[model samples]
Target: MNNFKTESFDLNRAFLLDSSHPPSSIVTKLHPLNKIMAEGQIHEDIPLLVMELDNQAIAFITPQLAYQHIVQGVLNGQAWLVSFCSICNGGAVFSPLVDDEVYSFQEGGFYDAMVLLYDVQSGSYWDHLTGNCLYGSLVGKELKRLSNLLHMSLRQVLAAYPDALLALSALPEQQQTEAEEDEAWRKASEPEWSKGLVKTLGVEDNRLPRLNMGLGVWTETTRRYYPVAQLYAMNNVLIDMVDGQRLITYIDPLSGTPGAFFTDASQAEWQHNILQLNNGDSMRDMVIFDANMMLKRPQRPFQLFVRWYSFALKFPNCEIYGQPVNTQG
Candidate 1:
């Protein structure tokens, strides 16, 4: 297995995408929902990177983020950065403030087979998945993660908040046709399109296939990865302990993505795409509890719906949910 180290910063291998001759371009500004609604609207079923701020539900279209790689914006007076790496099939929402100073970002390059984002203000490179500054003036700094970020469909987002705002692109005629959107979704769903990225990886971890998708949950002290296949094998719902907290994790039926929440409920089951908590109440989607709740309620851990190789490399010590424990005989 390969591990990422802060000490291994090489300028030559940084894959500087912001330089004059770059591989691709990124979106510098984010647009409001109403402005782009006339050109085209995101399909309700299309997955988006979303978060709730100040009782307002905001979403970042993933297809656009896949092409642009990064989008920076100010929402509810908070500076946010929504990022997606098509190669790694990973996405996250982050606060762009480092040392309480706001910073914009551009695609820097690639490190450890993942996207490295550099702040336009300090030119410091950061790991897109973990938000940790790797090299430059803010080498040891970290971007604050918006813990409530979830990968949900526009439909699911709307269900949660009927008037949720969709974040769009400010670029003129940036909307893709239905065919183009389908192609982008297909490429993201299947990682076979990333053969070129495979060539750029420094090392390969063979424990799990490079394209296997899973949910990776982490806290300041520990991390764990739960393969989707194993979750399905266990009836699409399972309970596990991570970072000293009991968590109920499942493949969300509405969006076909994974979600985890801190719960004290002893038993849970997936019934008709809704999770039934043993305590008479149920969870609709992403911990929207109905009736009496048995969960800790407020402590939703930081989780990422990511690929196996991506999580395995970044968190080398992560526990695999179904992996057998080894003991000395």
Candidate 2:
């Protein structure tokens, strides 16, 4: 592995490859959810990268995002970058402000079988998963990620916020249809079909199946992976320790999406997405009671509902829930 050290990241050049896309493919455009929905241009079942600002929902449809790779835009007066990696099945929303300056990105390349983005302003490369600058002048600099970035279906998002603004496809209908078809094929092709992608990933970690899906929870100090199948076996709710914080990880039956939240309670149980805390209160979602009414606590921990290979590669030695710890020094 060729190491390029930065304050925040050490990039390995061995597995990096140039992507077939040009830089800044999709930048700064949005349409109201009502308008796009009325046009019959969106699929309600597809998951979107969603975020809320002052109760206003902003969503990016995968059909549009997969073709674009990177979508940059302003929402609620803040610059944001929404990225989707079809290979990793990972989506992230990042703050494009670097050193207080708004930066634009293009499809820089790929590293460790994941997408790498480069800021148009400084020509530096960044890891889309962690938003850390790995190569170029901005090395060690990282994008501030919106911790509440959510992976939710348009149907679920609309149910919660009907007034959402969507980032719809700007491409021709034919191109959009083609992109959707390609996405479907990528999902349908199983373990054997992805051998090509697996080959690009240098130094495989066989602790878990390369394509296993899981929720990866992390903090600055440590990280952990919660495999989806294991969560189902445990009734979809688990109380665990991460970075010295006691937390809960569970799959919401309604959406079948995983979520992690900080908690002080000892244990919890869930049925049909309703979490029955050990305390008297019951939580329908990630929100728990705030310590003080005046101050709002973060509802969920920093996490990514990603595939096993992506998480395992990006975060080496990350603990796997329900598995014994690796005691190697």
The candidate that wins on lDDT is 2
Clashing pairs in 1: none
Whole-model lDDT per candidate: 0.70, 0.71
Worst 10 residues of 2 by lDDT: 1-10
lDDT of prediction 2: 0.71
Q: Candidate 1 lDDT, tens digit per residue, 268-321?
A: 998897788785657776645646554324466777788888887777656778
TM values, all candidates:
0.83, 0.81
User: How many Å off is the CA of 89 in candidate 1?
Assistant: 1.7
TM-score of 2: 0.81
Error of 1 at 185 (Å): 6.6
* Model 2 stretches with alpha carbons more than 4 Å out: 1-21, 25-29, 38-41, 53-56, 189-196, 283-298
